[model samples]
Target chain A: MTVTLAIDCMGGDHGPSVTIPAALHFLRADRKARIILVGRTEAIEPHLGTALAEFGERLRVHRASEVVGMDEPPAQAMRSKKDSSMRVAVDLVKSGDAQAAVSAGNTGALMAISRFVLKTLPGIDRPAICSTLPTLRGQTHVLDLGANVDCSPEHLLQFAIMGAMLVAAVEHNERPSVGLLNIGEEEIKGNETVKQAGELLRKSGLNFYGNVEGNDIYKGTVDVVVCDGFVGNVALKTSEGLAQMLATFLREQFSRNWMTKLAAIFAMSALKGFKHKVDSRRYNGASLLGLRGVVVKSHGSADAFAFEQAIWRAAEAARNRLIERITERMERERSAA
Target chain B: MTVTLAIDCMGGDHGPSVTIPAALHFLRADRKARIILVGRTEAIEPHLGTALAEFGERLRVHRASEVVGMDEPPAQAMRSKKDSSMRVAVDLVKSGDAQAAVSAGNTGALMAISRFVLKTLPGIDRPAICSTLPTLRGQTHVLDLGANVDCSPEHLLQFAIMGAMLVAAVEHNERPSVGLLNIGEEEIKGNETVKQAGELLRKSGLNFYGNVEGNDIYKGTVDVVVCDGFVGNVALKTSEGLAQMLATFLREQFSRNWMTKLAAIFAMSALKGFKHKVDSRRYNGASLLGLRGVVVKSHGSADAFAFEQAIWRAAEAARNRLIERITERMERERSAA
Candidate 1:
C-alpha cells in the first residue's frame, strides 16, 4: 500500500525554495510513497523535474491557482482563497486521495481550512494541534499548541482526550499519562477554566496525571500535556525563544576570546548535537487531531530537513490509524457512559 | 545614608540555611548596609554566629513568633499568622526599619501580607511581581509573573505602568517601552481582556509598544512585558524549564564520550558563563511593585548565591525608590487625565 501525502507547496517562509526540494526529497527517499504537489504550476514544475527522474510515475502535481497570504486572517483567507494550495491540500485528504495532508502556511488558516474541508471527528468539540517536543527524558506531546485560544472547560477536556489518544497512537503506549498545564502542581492552582478542566479530567477516568507545572513539561513527567490554546501557544513559543536565545548566547560567549574560540572548535560536535536536540525542525509538524482526516502543519520556517520530518510524521500518523483510533476510543467511552 | 534590608529568615525552601548566610555575605560586601533578620529567635540565632560577629552592629534579629506554611492559602495564612516572619518582614519595610524587604516564602502569602501590611501605592489597583530574565538581546522584565492571574483591564493597565516604572527604575532607561503580551501582534488578535487592555494602554500612552507575541519576549524587543499572573507565570516557568532542559541536554551530550568529555573540559568556561547568564538564581528575586513598600521574593530553592542576589535586587529597588517613582508617575497621569 503506497502512502500518499498532499503538500501545500506555496506555504512556509521560504516557500518553494524549501518546500519544493523537500517534497522531492521525500518522494526520492520512499519508493512506496507518492506526493501530490499543490501549488502554482510555474513555480513548482521547475524544482520537481531534476528530483522527479528517480520517482517518475510516483510524483504528481495538482495546480492550486490561488495562494493564501501569511498575513491574512484565517477565516478571511479561507473564504477568499477557496482554491488555495493549503485548502486544496486539505481537500485531497478529505476526498481520500491522500492519506494525510501537510502544510506550512499560516497556522490559523491551515486549522480553519482543515476543519472546514476535513470536518471534525464525532464526539470532538474542537480540533487541536498536537506537537511533539524533545525533552530531557525523551519527547513529550503538548496539545492545542494553537488551535482554539479561548477554550472552555469542555473544550479543554475534549482536547485532553484527543491529545492522549494521539500520543498513544504515535508513541504506541497502552495508556499515556495526561497532565493539565497549570501554574502549580496543586489541584486548585489554575484559573477557572483550568480548575473546571481538572475536575472534568479527574472524572473522565483517563490516565490523568493531575496538574503539571510549566517547568514539568520538559522534565518528561507526563506523556501528554493539555491546555487551552492561549497558554499552550505561549509556552511553546517561549520554549522555542529561550532555546534559540541560549544557543545564540552560548555562541557569543565562546566567540568572546581566543581561549573560548579554541574551546568552540573542540566543542563544535557537542554544540551541533545539542542544537539538533532542541531544534524546532526536528519536531516541525503538528497534527490537527480530532478531525476526521489527517492534517499536519509544518513549521512556517521549515527547510528541507524539517519538511522531510513532516512527511515522516504524516506517514507515521497515517500508518498508526490515528483518526480511527481516536474515533474508536470516543465511541467506547460514549457507550460505557 | 546606609541601606537596610529586612531578611525573612523563615522564607524559602531551606529558609535560614540560605538566607542567613546570604545576608551576612551582603553585609560583608556593603559595610554601609544594615540587615534585620526577621524570624523566631531560636530559628535564626543558630544560623548567625561568626557572620553576625563580623557584621557587629550592622546585623539585628527581629523576633517574629509565627511562620506561614508552604501549603497554606495566602488570605488564610495572612489572617492567621499575624506575627509570621513574612508579616514581620513587611512590617520592617512599613515602619521604615528597613529600606526593603526580601522573602522567599509562600508567594501568595508574601503578596497578600505585603499588600495588607505595606498597602498599595496611590492610584494602584493591585501589586505586581516583576522579575528580569536573560533574553537573546539582553534582559527584559516580565511583570505580574504570578500575582494577579485573572486581572481586569484596569488592573492590567496598572501592571503595565508599574512594570515600566520598575524597569525604568532599575534599568535606568529614560522611557521604557511596555508590551502587552497577547496571542498575536495584531491589535485585535487576543481575547476580550487583551483587547480592552490594548485600548487602555494606547490611551494611557507612556511609551506603549503594541501587542507582543511569546517569541518576542526573549528577543528583548520591549523593556517590559505585561500580562496577567496566569499567562506571565506560564511564560516565565516555561522559559526557565526550557533553559534548564537545554543546559542539561548539552551537559549530557558533552559527557557522552571521551572526545566530547575533552571538548567539555575546553568549553567549561564558556558554558559556565552561559549558565550564569541564564541562571534563575542570578535574577531570582521579583519586586512586588505597586505596594507602598519595596518587597522582593527570592526563589523557593534559592541558595546563598541566589539569596545574595535577592539582597542586591532589594537594595537596587530601594535605592531607585521604585514605590515613590510609581506613585509620582500615577499622580502625573491622573493629573493629566
Candidate 2:
C-alpha cells in the first residue's frame, strides 16, 4: 500500500527550499510512500530538478494558485486563501488522493484549514496538537500542545483517548498509559477539569496512571500525558526555552577560560552524546492529532533535515492508519464524553 | 529597627528538623534579623540546642496549639486549624510582631490562610505566587505560579502591575519590564484573556515588553512574566522536571565509560560551576505576592539550606516593604482594571 503525503510546498520561512528537499528525501528513503508537491510550479520546480527523474511516478507536483502568509490569521486565511498551497494540500487528503497532509506553515491557518477540510472525528470535541518530547527514559507523547486553548473535562478525556491511540499505533506500546498533567500527583490536586478528568480516566478501560505532574513529561513515566491546550502549550514552550538557555550556558561555560575550552575539546564526544539526548530538531514533527485525516505539522523554521523528519512522521502516521485507530478507540471508549 | 520573621517551624516535610536549623542558619548569617518560632515549643526546642545561646534574645519560640497536615484540604485547614503553626505564624505578621512569615507548609493551605489573614493588597483582586528563575541575564520573576487558576483579562493586567512592583521592590530593579506569557509573541496569538491582557498591558504605564513565549522566561527578556496560575504553575513545574532530567542525564553521561569518567574528572570545576549556576536551592523561595503583608513560601520538601534561603527572602521582602510598593503601584496605575 502506498502512503501518499500532500506537501504544502510554499509555506513557512524557507518555503520550497526546505520542503522540496524534504519531500525528495522522504520519498527516497521510503519505497512505499508517494508525495504530491502542492505549490506554485515555478517556485517548487527550481528545487525539484533531478528529483522528478530520480523518483519517477512516486513524486509529482500540483499547482496552487495562491499562497498563505506565515503570519495570516487562521479564520481569515481559511476564508480568503481557498486555493493556497496549505489549503490545496489539505484538500488532497480530503479527496483521498493522499493519505496525509504535511505543512510547515502558519500553525493556526493549517489547523483551521485542516479542521474545515477534514472535519473532526466523531466523539471528538477539539483536535489537539500532539508532539513528542525527549525524556530520561526515552520519549513522551504530550497532547493539546496548543490547538485548543480552553478545554472541558470531556475534551481532556477525548485527548487522553486519542493520545493513547496515537501512542499505541505509532509507538506500538500495547498498553500505553496516560497521565493527567497536574501540579501534583494526588487525586485531589489540579483545577476542575483536571479533577473531573481524573475521575473519568479512572473509570476508563485504558491504562490510566492516576495523575502526573509537569516533571513527568521529561521523566517519561507514561506514554501519553494529557492536559488542556493552554497548560500544554506553556509547558512545551517553557521546556524549549529552558533547553535553549542551558545550551547557551554550556557554550559560555566551555569558553570561559583557556583551561575550560581545552576541557570542552577533550569532552567533545560526551557533550555530543548529551546534545543528541536533548536535540530540538529530533522532536520537530508535531501531529495535528484528532483530525479526520492524518496531518503532521513541521516547525515553521525547520530546515531541510527537520522538514524531512516531519515528512517521515507523516508517512508513519499514514502507514499506521492513525486516524482510524483514534476513531476506533474513541468509538470504543469515551463515547459518553 | 530589627526586621522580625515568624517561622512555621512545624510546617514542612521534616518539620522543625528542617525549619529550626534553617532559622538558626539564617540568624547566624544576619545578626540584625529576629525570629519568632511559631510552633509547639517542645517540637522546636530539641533542634534549637546550642545555637539558642549564640542568638540569645533574637531567637525565641512562640506556642501554637494546632498543626495542619500537609495533605489536608485547603478550605478545611483554613477553617479547622486556626491555631496551627502556619496560622499563628501568619498572625504574627498581621499583628505586627513580625514583618514577614515563612512556611514550607502545604501550598494550598498557605495561600488560603495567607489570603484570609493578610488579605489582598488594595486594587489587587488575587494574590499570586512569584518566584525567581535563573536566566542568562540573571533571574526572572514569574507570577501566579499556583494561585488563581481562573483569571480574567483585568486580573492579568492586575498581575502584571503587581508583578512589576514586586520586581521593583525586591530586586531593586527600577523600571522593570513585564512580559505577558503567551503561546507566541504575536499580538494576534493566544486566547481571549491573553489577547485582552496584551491590549491592556500595552496601555499599562509599567514597562511592557509585549507578549513573551515560554522561552522568554529563561531568556530574561523581561524582569517579570505574568500569566494565569494554571499556565504559570505548569511552566514552573515543567522547568523543574527538565532541570532534574538534565542533571540526571549529565550524571549518567559522566559515568557511562571510563574515558568519559576521566573527561569528567578533568572538567570537575567547570561542571560544579555550571551546577551552582542552575542550583535549585538558589531559587528556592517563592513570594506569595499581592498580600497585605509579606509571605514567603518554601518548597515543601526543602532542606535546611533551601528553607534558610526562604527565610532570607522573606526578610528581604519585609525590609523592602513590598506590600506598600505594590499597593502604591497598583493604586497609581491599574486601578481601572
Q: Estimate each model's TM-score.
A: 0.95, 0.94
Write down the lDDT of every candidate, Cα atoms only. 0.87, 0.89
Residue A306, candidate 1: alpha-carbon lDDT: 94
Report iRMS (Å) of candidate 2.
1.1
Once fitted onto the true fold, the runs of candidate 2 whose alpha carbons sit more than 4 angstroms away are A203-205, A334-337, B79-83, B199-204, B333-337
DockQ of 2: 0.70
Best by lDDT: 2
- Model 1 per-residue lDDT tens digits across residues A1-337: 4889999999988888888788887777777889888999998877866665667777888989999888778989889888899999999998999999998899889988888888899988889989998888898999887777789988888888888888777789869999999888888787898999998889885899999888888888999999888888888888777777776888889998999999999998998888777777888889898899888888888889998898888987887888898898788767766
lDDT of 2 by residue, A213-259 (tens): 88889989899999988788889888888988888887888888999
**Chain B vs. true chain B: TM-score for each candidate?**
0.95, 0.97
Please provide, for model 2 over B1-337, each residue's C-alpha lDDT reduced to its tens digit, 9 standing for 90 to 100: 4799999998888999999988998898898999999999888888988876888889889999899998899999999988999999999999999999999999999999999998987778888899989998999999988787778988998888878887777789879999999988889778899999999889878899999988889988999999988888889889988999998888888788998899888787778778888888888989998888999999999999999999988998888878888878877784554
Best by TM-score: 1
